[model samples]
Target chain A: GAGVSQSPSNKVTEKGKDVELRCDPISGHTALYWYRQSLGQGLEFLIYFQGNSAPDKSGLPSDRFSAERTGGSVSTLTIQRTQQEDSAVYLCASSANRGRVLHFGNGTRLTVT
Target chain B: AQRVTQPEKLLSVFKGAPVELKCNYSYSGSPELFWYVQYSRQRLQLLLRHISRESIKGFTADLNKGETSFHLKKPFAQEEDSAMYYCALSDTGANSKLTFGKGITLSVRP
Candidate 1:
């Protein structure tokens, strides 16, 4: 793809429901990142995947949040038992390499009602 | 811990006027700073990085290590420049995950 692509641009789920967001990064990109943007808040780092190394999951808010990247290309972010506070935009970005410019996707807006 | 701060949530400026967006950061190690912008209905994109020392769309940001600041400036603001701007920092090491500041909204009025 010419740019990073995210699926299900909008998702509204009831509280306690699980939601999954997907990202397809640009071809040949070696680094990928996930972030959360609450209403009127800054981007919060969630996780980072660099090659085959263990993902940097330091920023995951809780055990309910998890992510996996398959074949070093597509990634998925799963939020379990979502809470109302989880309502936010989930953004995905990919870069050619670590410390390089990041290309972002339109993001998936998750509304936990 | 690396942190970035954008003090103003909203700024208003007339078209053709100069504009400056303030940003401050704290990091123990050498930092790599960057500016990112998001226009309406657009994805977030890089505006500039301290390492490149280049200007995009007439906007420039100079890293002041002593002050721990990297402020974005433009000689003349344009209506098209109205958008949300974010300041971000990353550690100079291999772990380049970025830490972003609360974004500032720029409103360029005609």
Candidate 2:
């Protein structure tokens, strides 16, 4: 891809429903990251993935939030039983080398009603 | 735990005036600091990093480990400089994920 791309730029869903967000990192980039920005938390780290190794899931708010990167190319973040608090701009970024610099996508605006 | 703190939520300055955005961090060991800027309706991009020690768009940031701060300074503020700025830190590791601050919004008035 030319740059980092995220799917479903904007999504509105009813509470308690499930939603999935997609992120397509830059080609040949190995490091990928997911972050959430809400009015309360400001910007919070959700997850981290590097190549094929195990992902750093330390930042996931709960078990309901899970992400997987397939073939080290694309990623999907699934939120089960969505809550209003989960509504925020979900940003995805990737770095070609390491975490030195990151290229960010336009971001997906998730709104839970 | 690693954390970046930008105490000021907002900063206001007139065009052609000197401007400074403060950023402080807390980490046990050495830290690599960076400054990122996001213009209105634009994706976030890196403005400068401490390691490179280079100036971009007349903005420079020095890593002052003594105070654990990386303050971004520009001699003359431009209207285009009005944007959201974030302070981030990363450690020396393969994963090297960034821990970002709450971010500060800079408004430059003409």
Candidate 3:
């Protein structure tokens, strides 16, 4: 892909429902990251994947938030039993390598009603 | 804990005026700082980094370790420079994950 791609640009789900956001990182990129941006807030780091190593999940806000990256290319973020506080933009980014510049996607705006 | 802090939430300046967006961070080890900008309806993009010490689109930032700050500055602001700016910090290691601050909104008015 020319740039990072995120699916379901906008999602409206009821509370307690499950939602999944997908990200397709730039081709051959070795690092991927997930972030959340609430209204009037900064980007919150959720998770990171580098090559084949264990993912850093320290940033996940709660047990309901989880993510998986398959084959180090595509990634999915799943939110179970979503709450009203989950209504925000979920952003995905990728860098050529660690410590390099990040390229971000448009992001998925989830609205928990 | 590694953290970035952007104090001002909304900043409005006339075009051609000098502009500065304040940022501060707290980290125990060496820090890698960057400024990311998001224009209206556009994806967030890298504006500059303290490590590169390079200016992009007339913007520059210098890391002040003593003050624990990395402020973004421009000699003369332009209307095109109006955007949401974020300050980020990376820990010292191969798996350098970024921690971002609450962004500041810069509105360069004509």
Question: For this target, which candidate reaches the highest DockQ against the unseen true structure?
Answer: 3
Write the residue-wise lDDT of candidate 1 on A43-88 in tens digits: 9999999974535889999999999998999999999999999999
What are the per-residue Cα lDDT tens digits for candidate 3 across A1-113? 48999999999999999999999999998899999999777899889989645458898999999888889799999999999999999999999988569999999999999
Query: What's model 1's lDDT at A113?
Result: 92
Candidate 2 backbone clash number: 0
Decide which is better by lDDT, 2 or 3: 3
Tens digit per residue, CA lDDT, model 1, B88-109: 9988788789899999999999
For each candidate in turn, the TM-score is 0.98, 0.97, 0.97
Residue A62 in candidate 3 has what lDDT?
Answer: 98
Across B1-109, the per-residue lDDT of candidate 2 in tens digits comes to: 9999999999999999999999999999778999988899998888999989999999999999999999999999999999999999988776678899999999999
Kindly provide the TM-score of model 1 when superposed on the true structure, using C-alpha atoms. 0.98
Total backbone collisions for each predicted model: 0, 0, 0
Q: State the TM-score, rounded to 2 decimals, of chain A in model 3.
A: 0.95
Per-model lDDT: 0.93, 0.90, 0.93
Report the poorest 10 consecutive residues by lDDT, candidate 3 chain B.
B90-99
CAPRI-style grade of the A/B interface in model 1: medium
Error of 1 at A77 (Å): 0.3
Candidate 1's C-alpha runs over 4 A off are none
User: Which of the two candidates, 1 or 3, achieves a greater DockQ against the reference?
Assistant: 3
